[model samples]
Each structure stands twice: as C-alpha cells, then as structure tokens.
Target: MLTEEMMTTTEMILMTYLFEIDEWLKDKKVIQQQQAQLTKEELVTVIKNDLTTFQANQATDYEKKLQTTLTTLEALSEAQFQKMKLEILSWGPNVKHVD
Candidate 1:
C-alpha cells in the first residue's frame, strides 16, 4: 500500500498529466473544426495540423486508459502499470492507420 506521501505524489503527477492532455485535446478539437471549412488545397496546408490533432486525441485516450488502470492498480495491487504500458506500446505501430 502506498504511504500518504506516495499517494499524494502520484495524484499530483496524474493530475498534471491529465490536465495537459485535456488542454491538448481541447485545442485539437478547435483546430479540427477550423479545418473542416477549408478548401482542398487550403486543407492540405492544415493536414499536418489535423494529423497532430488525431495523434493528440489518440494519446489522450491511451493516457486515460493508463490512468484508469493505475487507479485500479493502486487499490488492488495488480501489475496495472505494466499491463497499461503494454497496451500503450501496442498502439504505436498503428498510429498512422487512422481513417
């Protein structure tokens, strides 16, 4: 079981990471809406923007999954971190396969 100090440290780290991810996703969604109004050539100018947004969303989702696993692990003593690490790794090879 985590000492109070360890739990507090973990909570801070998790909160900061989650906040960053949430902000990134919000920014991405705004950019994506703007992208939706572009002409083909103009849209090409923002393709990288779109791709970055897509990746951000994917990362956020994976991080959320990891966070949930961590929370459960903290209480259950399961190897949640390692299991979530593997799940995160599996997503890397297929990142560009987005539709």
Candidate 2:
C-alpha cells in the first residue's frame, strides 16, 4: 500500500537510527576502555604504596630485633666478666695480684 516516496522516507529514517545507534555504541566502548585504564592505574598506585609501607615496617622490626640482640649480648658479656673476676678473687693468696 506504500508509495515509492513513502518507502524511500522509511528507509532513510531507518538508516539514520542505525547510524546513531552505532555511534552511541562506539562512544560507550571508548568510555568503558578509559574507565578500565583509570582503574588499573589506581590499583597499581595502591599496590606500590602498600609495598613501600610493608618494607618500612619490615625494616623497623629488623632494627628492633637487632637492638634487642645487642643488648642481650652486652648483658651476658658483663655477667661472664663478673663471674671470672669472682672466681679469681676466691683463689685468695694463691692468685697473684698483677697490675
């Protein structure tokens, strides 16, 4: 029942709609890709910050442990020196009092 002019008009309308839909889809894809890239960059920054914090904490813990070990060694050395001094003193007159 459609005339030739009506068929041509309908075809033109359909083509316009299809072109608009295609353009919208392409824009959507570009926006999605940009969002994905931003998310990846944010994640990388967070991971790097976390790694830096972890390394700092590890270094602090190591220093604390090393200090504790040094303190313990110094105490043990002092106690041993005192024990040797007492042993020598207990020998009384038999031990020489060398300067």
Candidate 3:
C-alpha cells in the first residue's frame, strides 16, 4: 500500500544505506592497507578493535535502520510518508547535536 511519494522516499533511504555500506567497506580496505604498513601487534590490535566495534554496535545499528525503513515503507500512506520523512531528517541533526 505504499504511495508514490512513500516509494520515492523509501528508495532514497535504501540508496543512502547502500552508499553508507559501500563507504564502510571502503574504510575496511583502507584499514587493511594501514594494517599492512604496521608491525604485527599493532595491526592485530587495530583489526581486533574494528571487528569488535562492527560486531557490538555499528553493523547492528545500520541493520536496524535498514530493516525499520523497509518495514515501515511497505505500509506507507501520504501522511505516513511525511512523518517518516521528518523522522529520517531529524536523525542527522540529532546525531550531530550529540556529544
């Protein structure tokens, strides 16, 4: 039951998510390159920290955002679209405002 507007917004969200995933994967490559230039223990520690962050929070956060966006998009109407748009827009400012 998604309206045209809703579908457009949802598509935008999915595209943004894909872009973020791509950037993070790129970051992984950069980290790998950095690791290659480091001594063994330093490389191991950096990688371990990155993996822990990925497992404990970053990946889970993105997955949740994507799932929620998809689930909500499936049942969207015009009013719902506007509301969701506001919520999505707010996320950025709220994040920036956080310490």
TM-score on alpha carbons, each prediction: 0.24, 0.20, 0.27
Q: Candidate 1, residues 1-37: lDDT per residue as tens digits?
A: 5455444443333333223435444542112234223
Instruction: Return whichever of 1 and 2 wins on lDDT.
Output: 1
Q: How well does candidate 2 match the true structure in TM-score terms?
A: 0.20
How does candidate 1 score on lDDT?
A: 0.38
Model 3 pairs in collision:
none
Score each candidate by Cα lDDT.
Answer: 0.38, 0.35, 0.42
Better of 1 and 2 by TM-score: 1
User: What is candidate 3's lDDT per residue for 1-99, written digit by digit as tens?
Assistant: 545644554545433422343544454211223322443234234434444555643467544444445554445555554464444334431133231
Q: Model 2 over residues 4-78: C-alpha lDDT tens digits?
A: 444333233222222343544454211223222323234234434443555653466534433333233233344
TM-score winner? 3
- Which numbered prediction scores highest in lDDT against the true structure? 3
Q: How does residue 26 of candidate 1 score in lDDT?
A: 53
Residue 63 in model 1: lDDT: 47
The C-alpha RMSD of each candidate to the native structure, in angstroms, is 17.3, 42.5, 15.5
Single out the weakest 10-residue window by summed lDDT for candidate 1.
Answer: 28-37
For candidate 1, what is the total of clashing residue pairs?
A: 0
